[model samples]
Target: MQAQSLSYYEILHLPPPPHTTPTISEIRKAYHSALLEHHPDKSILTANDSSTPTVDEIVEAYNILSTSSLKVLYDQQLESVQQSKKIEEARFKRLIAQADSIDLDDFQTATSCVQHSKDIFAESSSITLSTGYARESCHGYPEDTCNLQQIWFRNCRCGKDDAYLVTESMLEHAFLESDNAQSDDRQILVQCSRCSTWIRVLFSLAE
Candidate 1:
């Protein structure tokens, strides 16, 4: 994923806003852990796992997050991006509804007009679980027997209850890349069915 598209908190594996800001100690711990896990040598050892983030990217994320002044600026930008997304989502839905009666050419034109808005929010926006961070077990089955996989719900800012549905496989995918389950928690992005807003589910995998 592009570094600009993700928050510094995510790069460091710490919870982002709408949740408590991590302490310096927590940030330091996460930075060291990320360095160990996503090290260039580690990537080489793993046969050049293309999915691994570059060391420079990790260091950049650390630099911004570790500095209080930069962190504030970063947080403001995140908020601005989120606000723009919500506005775009609302506008797009209205346009879609209105476009139903328009000709195909007109519909295409209308959509293209909002391309900039779409680009701004194209990446999955991250957020914590409404139920708070909870421990989950995998039940020895790859993804099938994770009993707690029952659809978890989160309310959306759109005033819809249970609009964000957390599914079984979503949990599995987050931890799939990990060589160690107990090392740290992982995040999976989900969207609000009603608002089309993306959410990052931060969760832990318990053996």
Candidate 2:
């Protein structure tokens, strides 16, 4: 099975920590049960089948949990991982909610086809044009001012480096589409060139 994706507690069928920490006895019992159920010699399943984890995986899980120090460290790491996942989920939900709230009629009338926002989206600040660290590629920028204008790039969560791009003309187009009198607070939605994920590129058009 894809036991690598699962935590040690999950591998042993024991309760994960913080919410419900399994005792040493419970870990031991689960470990033995897994060995009995999945041991290569004891298992009747075909070699090609990946229904159960290998004997090595079970032993690795058991070794970590059986040790008090390692279990504590693993619990902390697991909690951090779970917290990050929750945060990402919340951000994704907010993005979805914002998308649902948009008036399709108004969006259709906008000059730029890309989505615009009056408020900043999550992670918007993380990939700022002011950073100057990201690669600058002017290839697809406005043809007339291509030399002076270049697209800024940021790494995407999909592991693609410099996948998210924001161009000077794109920001200008997004700003022109805004109906708001205040020009200091505006953002444009930019999708990763390599992935389907979208990120907001915050900027000000005010001179």
Candidate 3:
């Protein structure tokens, strides 16, 4: 499925000419001549079939060297090959210096630090928060009638009588609280202690 690299001379199976670059016309001529000589369709009736290459092979070779982008890439590859010895020499020197300084103790220290970080992360891998509310009334001046008056907070924290009455503004505040705290890996539930109403807050630790 992937195209293979080929040099211009290799594609045409020709010897490289001395101090010369072939023109586009010369390249085209060489391609057609090679194809006519070796293409499977042309060689099917020839007695020397063993010497001929396949049509696909000839087409693939021509397709690469004939295109400007592909030819440029091939030339660049050739340049890289010519420079590879120098590159490898530099790399070998750097590696020797690194090898001289690297030690097993340093590797162990890095591994331990990574494991410690992972352990700290595992402590609060996930958290859940939820909230709900309930209403209650006490006997007062309007004793005969039941009122919808209610106290609200995050989760039930009874006996303190510190729960605030729910209002439009207070409800908005509670929603914001949950939204702001959702990103932490800590569970915080708030509710009216006396009314047994509550809200859950979920948060997670940063990665």
Candidate 4:
């Protein structure tokens, strides 16, 4: 299905405001205005059309955009859309790994390969690698259970097996690494001194 096209600010018809935040009163006012304009009952009566969206739509939109937790979810949805094009392009490039048609077993293997590549490249000063994977598990028992995984990597060593998991913190670290490695041949391997599950880094020299 095509995703919804409403952002928090757009839902409330407000300008793209700063993260400094708005007060509850301001939120409520914006919500009420949106409700008045879009409530299906009013629209149907005035426009004599059954295709108008219902009051529930307005309520749901307001609930999502006005509350802190819901607002965060809405913001994430927006971000997902904004990043979707880049994600699709990356996925297309990895078509051979059938990275687009990966299974659970392949996913785990791909993740390990990608992580390994990132670790190796992260030791250099001129290049860097970042990897990420995301997967969702099925809801059934042992036999029926399964997971769908999506992997992504960037600026790291590109190899047949190098596909990694994606995470919010990883993205932030990658950005920081990119910034720090701009002028130096310095390599930084940001790995867990313990489990070593999460790794992000920049490098200047060969692995």
lDDT of every model, 2 decimals: 0.59, 0.62, 0.45, 0.46
- Could you estimate the TM-score for every candidate? 0.45, 0.48, 0.31, 0.33
Spell out the clash pairs found in candidate 2. none
Which ranges of candidate 3 are over 4 A from the true structure?
A: 1-6, 14-18, 44-53, 82-207
lDDT of 2 by residue, 1-207 (tens): 345487778778887866787878888999999888887778787234565577788899999999999888888898899999999999977774443221112221111112221112222534333332222322233435323444555666688665565655776787788887554667777666676677665666651
In terms of lDDT, model 4 sits at: 0.46
| Better candidate number, 2 or 3, judged by lDDT | 2
lDDT of 3 by residue, 142-161 (tens): 43433232222221245433
Candidates 1 and 4, the one with greater lDDT: 1
How much does candidate 4 score in TM-score?
0.33
Ranking the candidates on lDDT from highest down gives: 2, 1, 4, 3
Which sections of candidate 2 miss by over 4 Å? Answer: 1-4, 100-207
lDDT of 1 by residue, 36-124 (tens): 88787664563365554567777888888889999999889888988999998998666544321211121111111111222222332
State candidate 3's TM-score: 0.31
Candidate 4 per-residue C-alpha lDDT over 1-207 given as tens digits, one digit per residue, 9 for 90 to 100: 111544556656666544546667787898788678766555556344334434565567667666788777767777687689789777645543332222222222223233233333454433322222212111122423323232334321234233344433344454466656545433223323222232333333331
Each prediction's RMSD to truth: 18.6, 13.8, 25.9, 16.7
